[model samples]
Target: MSDIFNQVDNSIYSNAMTFLRVPLVMDPIAAEADIAVLGLPFDIATSGRSGARMGPTAIRQASINLAWEGKHFPWKFNLLKKSKVIDAGDLVYSTGDAAEFTQKVEKAATQLLASGKTLVSLGGDHFVTLPLLRAHHQKFGEMALIHFDAHTDTYDNGSAYDHGTMFYHAPNEGLIDPQKSVQIGIRTVFNEANHGFNVIDAPQANDMSVEQISTLIKEKVQGMPVYVTFDIDCLDPAFAPGTGTPVCGGLSTDKILKILRTLTDINIVGMDVVEVAPAYDNSEITALAAATIALELMHLWTVQNKQV
Candidate 1:
């Protein structure tokens, strides 16, 4: 009999649902893959709408639309050819228990990092980044954060498990250096008094050229290990209406892509794309956007490795 698991199946509609049609290997270390894709499917911490729990499935399914593009455009080489990438599937945890979710995610991440695999995560909500940061910090020490969102996620008044408060706790835990961090596309209200992070608000980001924006980001992070977290609500509701707690007047998808494309040299060690709730989406655009951004991140990793 032929080895069915090793057979190539790139059909857009008929195949096992893995991100970008990559092999689904639950044990990434044993497979000796360079990149591991993991999903966090818990959104109990969301303060607004709840369907972000379904985000992982939506994002993976939408990635089928991008499977046919071997080189992913503009980029000079094929991503999967340059590096071995596999979907490790979603994190399994006790439903509705926030503490358990945190423990499981951090432990899983630590294991993957210890095995020397670059992790690309898909979020259930923005809260997931805290544990992810904890795992990355243990392996790489303190990191510079590159956050893309409509909110700073720095609210000090929220409960222990709120999604809007991860950054507030992350700095306190010494997982990231706030002074070395940059928060982009923020339009919502946040304390300006002592937030520490360099804020490039929505209006400011729109006014600046992509080169200027990329330069500012590189200056802030400056040779430190970087962790990039993109909250889908950073895009205006017109571009990503499927997210919970979306604000108006945010960055356009085109502009964000341009900025990301220019940052191929930054030392990004880990990344995640969050808040893609498909129930509110029109024509699957939000999930597709998330998938494309995730793929771009992989290309960034591939290019960085090539440079090294």
Candidate 2:
């Protein structure tokens, strides 16, 4: 019915730009979907990189290939079979104004959540989580964060606009529950003293099996409303070298996917895949990884919220 299927049947190169060639809608409520894909293209807060602003478009381009895959592996059902998903396009905000941008992000996210459709966000940078958290909290109260990153992002205090400082404010501002939250694959330095978050640092994660990590995550969250924010940098530099701040050692893509596959009923409310600066990516792997992750998030949403 669509050019995505008609002209490019099974082709990785599709003429459609919307993620997976799903309809691009400005009016999400009119789209009648169970999930809304929102793009946040503000990257002014990046401390180490600036190109993540282009991430959303690159991710969409990469996802053209996924639209042709009938059934995603490991999951027997097609993600879209049970419900509708609309790409609500990218959030618009004033250019170059970080303060105004955060407000726009929060306002737009709040509006999407108001539609009662789960949101799968495509991020400009890790800092975008701040506004997202604010909006999600207003809906689900304080959520337990399932953060995937190379840095703890709990810089404690300093540089309010920096991506590294979002968690420092998120819990304090009541957007997330630090005690119920967990940061996985962290290799950077951050204060740990009773900071509330349970951290599975890179070394610790590497030593543990994927099942062990997944069990730990499930235990910490314990059915609390969860918000998953995945930084592509959480993958080792060999896997995701296009991110702003690349760390040498981190979770392998296989390890992260294995863990996520086990999180089928963890009460996830919202999710995002951030920091795919395509300029530095090798052979589009970073964008493809982000797209695959995004699709998996959709699978998680669909299968868990199954039709009664």
Candidate 3:
């Protein structure tokens, strides 16, 4: 999506609203983008802090720092140059009903995917991934999930709408194949039942090198369509404190980004950076972190689907 996700030459402090000020579109197909960005601004499913509903705006504002820059550092390619990216704006849905909200998100996602554009979501909370999975499943057909978070979010948790239970429900609904998936950066507790996905708990991730973590992720998701979900709380509170459920002893910022950079070879279907609650953040740290993660995701997408 050349010039799609990015706006032309606005100062970082300028009034850019869309994620990186990319042209806002109501219809992705008309834009003919290679990739599209959408905001899932519903946090009704959170079991913790409530303000993730504001995540989309906050992350977009922070992304201004990256928007005006011609190219991202360390990476040898220009994302805007290689791909057409557009901000399709946020999903429009009634805020009153959980079922309706989920349906709207999925419907919006389905429409975007039908355009044959890959999606990168700015989430309202981790629960947003549930509907996202539903949408991607229809296109890619049961992807391998690469989840990064402080909690497994796979708990039964009684209700079908809770953020913690989406993973539990996803595998059952045929959206993802648990055996081919892997969950990383988890520090919270959950039953070790043959949940099918391999676990790289927080301690394990912290102790492991980037090579080890990436190797394990690649091995687990080998030759499969992959969907990556990064919950901002995967970083310690020191790195990302403005999240719904922050956990200590998490991976550092450098550690996670490094791991992501080495993952361009994976067949990624869809991705999101969820659970960033800017209200709890100091000095915009969490939002900026989320923004950077989003950019890195674009890099990953561009490399995988390199355009002429």
lDDT at position 97, candidate 2: 87
Clashes of each: 0, 0, 7
Best by TM-score: 1
Give the TM-score (vs. native) of candidate 2.
0.95
Q: Write the per-residue lDDT of candidate 2 for residues 1-308, one digit (tens) a residue.
A: 77655554456774657888888897885668889988888788888867999999989998987887678887788777776889999988778888988988888889878878889999899999998999999999989999999998888555768888899898889888888999999998777776679999999999999889998999999969999999999999898878888999888888888888989879999999998898888888899889999998888878789861
Evaluated against the true structure, the overall lDDT of model 2 is: 0.87
166-225: candidate 3 lDDT, tens digit per residue: 899999999988889999999988888766779999999999999999999999899999
**Candidate numbers, best lDDT first, in rank order:** 1, 3, 2
Best by lDDT: 1
Instruction: Write the number of the candidate with greater lDDT, choosing between 2 and 3.
Output: 3
Task: Give the per-residue Cα lDDT of candidate 1 at 123.
Answer: 86
lDDT-superior candidate, 1 or 2: 1
C-alpha local distance difference test of each model: 0.92, 0.87, 0.89
lDDT tens digits, residue span 1-308, model 1: 56977667778777748898788897776778888999999789999998898899999999999989887877878888889899999999987899999999999999999998999999889999999999999999999999999999999998888999999999999999999999999998888998899999999999999989999999999989999999999998988999988899999999989989998888999999999998899999999889989988988888888642
RMSD of each: 1.6, 2.1, 3.4
**TM-score of each predicted structure versus truth:** 0.97, 0.95, 0.95
Ten-residue stretch with the least lDDT total in model 2:
5-14
